[model samples]
Target: MDDPVTFARKLRREQTLPERRFWGLVRPWREAGLHWRRQAPIGPYVVDFVCKARNLIVEIDGDTHYSEAGLAHDESRTAYLAERGHRVLRFTNSEVTQGGEGVYTVLMGVLGEPGAER
Candidate 1:
């Protein structure tokens, strides 16, 4: 964790279940020219997924994110990203695991594709 490069590399190698699932869902989008990078380092943080072209960062929050300290940290991190003009989208682990279709639909909507009714 001392080195940001090393930390990002480790995160990519040890992706959580939700992270793995999310990546699987979006990997093919690269062919459509929606390039995304997993465990991308932006500033001092390593975002779960980032599409620089769209200025979008998607984060999959786990249990710890609900705690007071974690929430505070996330708030600041989000503010920092916003200051840099990046829009952040956060999804819980449960949301991705149990409602994957819904998550995919939301992402499609954010990506500006048609037919994302909800």
Candidate 2:
């Protein structure tokens, strides 16, 4: 009976290793003046990270996400967010763990310059 709010809180506390790793890199973006939220609830799902200002949601997927069910759910989630005018960025756990600079570059490209607010 864990509600979304409580579940999101638990997720924030128990973030996966990749989530933590990526957060370390992305969190510093705030210092550059870009806003992002971790373990944020959008509609029904609690996305791993989101920049509402940019209408972006970043999800770090673990092994479970490769399953058929997980893939279907993610597709639905992405479709829903897209319907709401939000863009979704999905990264596998290893991608964040290994592709540090690459991933950051991609994010920066999508996010634009730090202080360059839209």
Give RMSD to native, each candidate. Answer: 3.0, 1.4
Clashes of 1: 0
Candidate 1 is scored at a TM of 0.91
lDDT of candidates 1 onward, in order: 0.87, 0.87
Q: What is the lDDT of residue 112 in candidate 1?
A: 58
Prediction-by-prediction clash tally: 0, 0
Per-residue error for 44 in candidate 1, Å, reads 0.8
The runs of at least 3 residues in candidate 1 whose Cα sits more than 4 Å from the true structure, single-residue gaps closed, are 114-118
Q: Write the per-residue lDDT of candidate 1 for residues 1-118, one digit (tens) a residue.
A: 5577789999998999999889877755666667799999899998999989889999999999999999999999999999999999999998888858888888887885532222
lDDT of 2 by residue, 47-88 (tens): 899888889999998889999999999999999999999999
Model 1 root mean square deviation, Cα atoms: 3.0
